[model samples]
Target: MSAAAQRVDTGRAAHGALARQLRLARQGRSMLFPFIGRSRRFEIWAHYPRHDAVDSSGRWQFYFHVHDRAEKDSARHPQEHGHIHLFRRSPQGKLTHFAGLALDARGLPLCWFATNQWVTGERWADAASLVRELAHFELRLRGPLSGAGLWLGDMVRFYATPLRQMLEQRDAALERHCRRHDQTRAQAWADRRVAVWSSLPVNWPQDALSAAGPLTQ
Candidate 1:
């Protein structure tokens, strides 16, 4: 009934429609990642229908590179502590915009802004309701859709540990950064940030979907 609720509903509806289309398009599919070698190198990839793109059929897909242990350790600058990259392509195979997720050292998403010639930002909690919405969308593609399961599996393998480490390190770094910046205010600021993040609704509309069944039907 509220504006925030409306936005969430819209996102759910959009995702549901996209999922059905994916099911139909990929019905006989067995493996989403046919490419060989280090599939783990590429995690969290999915194709979704999008109207904004030049192509109408919505073949656009995005991939996320949460963290590359090898590259992150080797890179000279390492501007990204850990990030998600999104890519899209037209049905004709023309490249579209590439986006990124920028998180602080603690892995909490920041505001959506652009970086490195790519769009980057935190997920909108107000609009999305739950962090898992993003994860679920990725998983759904792997689930009912078949063949795409590898994407979800690879995502879990590649990101699970690194993401956990990123969050832990981020929290530690914030605590340290705050203490160094101002010992007297560090605890208060950290507490406030934690409270704010915790207070934000982090559960998806699982109950609604469970009661209503798959939105695609």
Candidate 2:
């Protein structure tokens, strides 16, 4: 892995950014307002931003969307409004999903998760490769969503450790499923029953405040 991939950040920046956005949301301008503003009626399974939020470098991208009711893991995240799926794009345009950040109605993150290949139909990559790509995650946008982009990037750094563990757990789960079912890795990857490979909940409001530290100072 590259040195950049090993870089991590305190969540202060993310917490401050989110605090600002939340204040705005209370006044009717949400971080999600940019993407959902034009939709007459936002529908489930429809990815906000249409094409997606590609970073300035075009190598990183993400989009927010809600899954169909049946696909939601309400047992784990009852308040999940949706999730932001992050992807790493190759120069040749092959896209690899690295992680997903589930958020509640107020746009606060609820958890980070890893999914199977069939979930995103992405160019499957190992946890180590995905971890290496983490240092390269960036999304510099200029608009109402600019701060939102920065917050998203900060989130990757904030939860880097858990994200790494989740990815590793995902891989391990896949291996276990393959062995238990006597199926090849490829077959296990395509198994519809195994959608979410791993997930870890975020302890919200309290955790966010703690990570933010003394923002006023």
Candidate 3:
């Protein structure tokens, strides 16, 4: 086979493997969630897309929705299609960790990414706690379900620390950036976020989706 043909063959084989794993992940009989629980210390929830939970902010918000539905259109595909979002809440009723599984058409996770939006409080203590728990959010892949799990694990290991650092760095940079650009507006926004977080109800949901349920449209 030509080099191009060989490359295509390899890609097809990988895709097939991913499809098989996604099916395994979707199987109702698997005790994967319990196994995942043993590897990590956080409550995990897995389910198909809930149209009711879709965010009005489109794909930019917490929820995931496919942007492109074409069969061979990965280039222009949505940010997160066939994947699950993991939420880690602190014992103090604050959302401290957030991760997502970005899956391919076969529902096999291919990449992992972390976000900085989880840290919204002015109190460094709260932000610090969220970051600490995020370090241990592992996504394990074993046997036929290894594709998504391995990808998730890699994402947790690679991006978790970097995302936290970036969030801190971004916060500091935003302070400076805003001061240089529009100090008053930036200060007001910061103050509002601090106040909002400080005044959050003591019983706030530990998960973002649950917390956002009331506000979800």
Candidate 4:
């Protein structure tokens, strides 16, 4: 288990840059706007949730979007705006899907969840392995994508406890599904009908306002 696979102390709120960028983006438009500067407004809205935030080293990345994404039949999980998918590219170059941050129409985070393979077309990693990667998900290289990576890393730290809990529930859900249905069907987890397997309600960060800043030189 490398340190990158473990949680560590992140510096001050400077990494809150991602959230700040999101806020500025919403200044005159809608939820999660100002994407890469804009392309005819909502014309590109809801389009596969662009990967605006990324790590130069490709170790970790984060991207978010909004739309109706919830079980149509079940009211247990009310659909909100959309979700942010976090990714990690291993040294072996394998792309692993970590977890998702569900957001409201107003761009506020509502829940944390894990999706089946079909949803994001990503390789599956057990909850334990994904948990370890959360800490080292940082992007320090100087570039357009740097701030977003740092901001995402901050998000993992800020909601570490709750995120971990939701992932546990995700694993439990998969086990229950397999036992009741068919264990031999490895692709069962990739069923398109089930987008989000497990989720936990999230409280919007109070520090978001503080994240805006009064930077001192």
Candidate 5:
């Protein structure tokens, strides 16, 4: 098959996988229901599942958590209920943050974003490298949260093009920030003032529809 045909097939698969997951999760309650379980309270900064969801091989992992109201930069993400931090384990066993997805109260995706090093305390990777690695971000696990994990992976794959663009924008933003502050990229990368470096809004339902016709440009 042609490369273009392969891409279209992959994009459609991702969209179908994600849509199915969303349907199953919503049959009982909101999509967040599985991950949050029956907890009456979701404390700020506390990782839900009480532990992150890691694949059997410990390669890919993710966790959902809410920020304290006081800690949120309202001007940036005013409506977020929480966000999932996606990571991949390096050969050295260090978890590297590649991308993040923010969600609203209904557990619908709001946007895709990349943050400075200090935000996730991740092993630093450039945008190009991260984008390349994103294709391997599948989550293979078992039990109730397994569906949630699968949904996350499909979300990344489905939004692959835009996510790559977001990462590129992140790198560009970092360069400009460093220049504005007269600091090296490394220095700016560690600056708390540069928490969320780049972000792009997402509407998953519409995106899924578009994916069925032609792969996003």
Candidate 6:
């Protein structure tokens, strides 16, 4: 098969896998809230429900949290339950930002997006490089939330094209921002207003679920 075919295959496989992960978790009655834990539910200014929880292997790391409700910004970032920031580190390596996905109260994905360097405090990776990594992601996380981990990484492939589009747009947004201020690319990458860039409305898993599932436990 050609490389293009291979990428399509990988993306199709990832979509199916992610959808199944959600289904199984729903069957287990764990769904989405389990990761948040009960203790930190309403704590203000907290990383939600707590900190960046890493998988047992310490490779896949993520956290779900929200901005201060009073904090105003673009309408694109409407206040929601919160958003989860995703990251991955290969064996014996350090974590790199994956992308951010916003979730609604029903636990459905609302959008796929990115933020400024200041937002995630994550190591920088350019668009082309990140796009190359997207289709190759195959996270085999351990234990009960194992599927969730795989789902997170695979979701990138499942949404590979848009993910790449997001990366390109992120860079473009930064470029336009830097041009506007006559700042270098590196300087504009840190701009707060240009922080959230490259977003697309949520799609996929819901369609997959409809075709292959009944989401209730």
Deviation from native of the Cα of residue 98 in model 1, angstroms: 5.0
* TM-score winner, 1 or 2: 2
lDDT of 5 by residue, 13-84 (tens): 566656655576657666677778667887888887788888777887788888887764843567788898
- Writing each residue's lDDT as its tens digit, candidate 6 over 1-217 gives 4777866655465556556655755566333554554554466556643655676756667767766667776734563557778876667666667788877655566788887776766677788877776656666655545666666665666677778888899889888877888998667767666667677777646644543344342
**Superposed Cα deviation of residue 200, candidate 2 (Å):** 1.4
Compared with the true structure, what per-residue lDDT tens digits does model 4 show for residues 108-140?
566777787777777788889877765544555
Report the poorest 10 consecutive residues by lDDT, candidate 4.
5-14
Compared with the true structure, the alpha-carbon lDDT of candidate 4 equals 0.60
State the lDDT of candidate 1 residue by residue for 123-217, as single tens digits.
21121122222332333233222333233333322232233343344345445656665654334343433321111111122423442345554
- Clashing residue pair totals per candidate (backbone < 3 A): 4, 0, 0, 1, 0, 0
Model 5 local distance difference test score: 0.77
Candidate 2 lDDT by residue in tens digits, 1-217: 3544343255554565667667766678765666677789999988888888878787888888987767745334677888888898888888898888888877777888888888899999999988876555567887656767887877777676788888999999989999899999899989888878899888765666676665552
Q: After superposition, how far is residue 206 of candidate 1 from its true place, in Å?
A: 18
CA RMSD, predictions in order: 13.3, 3.2, 16.4, 5.0, 3.6, 3.8
Global fold similarity of model 2 (TM-score): 0.86
Q: List the residue pairs that clash in candidate 1.
A: 30-147, 105-170, 106-170, 112-121
Off by over 4 Å in 6: 1-30, 38-41, 48-51, 55-59, 90-95, 204-206, 209-217
Error of 6 at 6 (Å): 4.7
- TM-scores of the candidates are 0.27, 0.86, 0.35, 0.71, 0.87, 0.77
Candidate lDDT scores, in order, read 0.33, 0.77, 0.37, 0.60, 0.77, 0.66
Tell me the deviation in Å of residue 134 in model 3.
4.5
Residue 185 miss distance in model 3 (angstroms) = 9.1
On a 0 to 100 scale, what is the lDDT of residue 186 in model 6?
A: 68
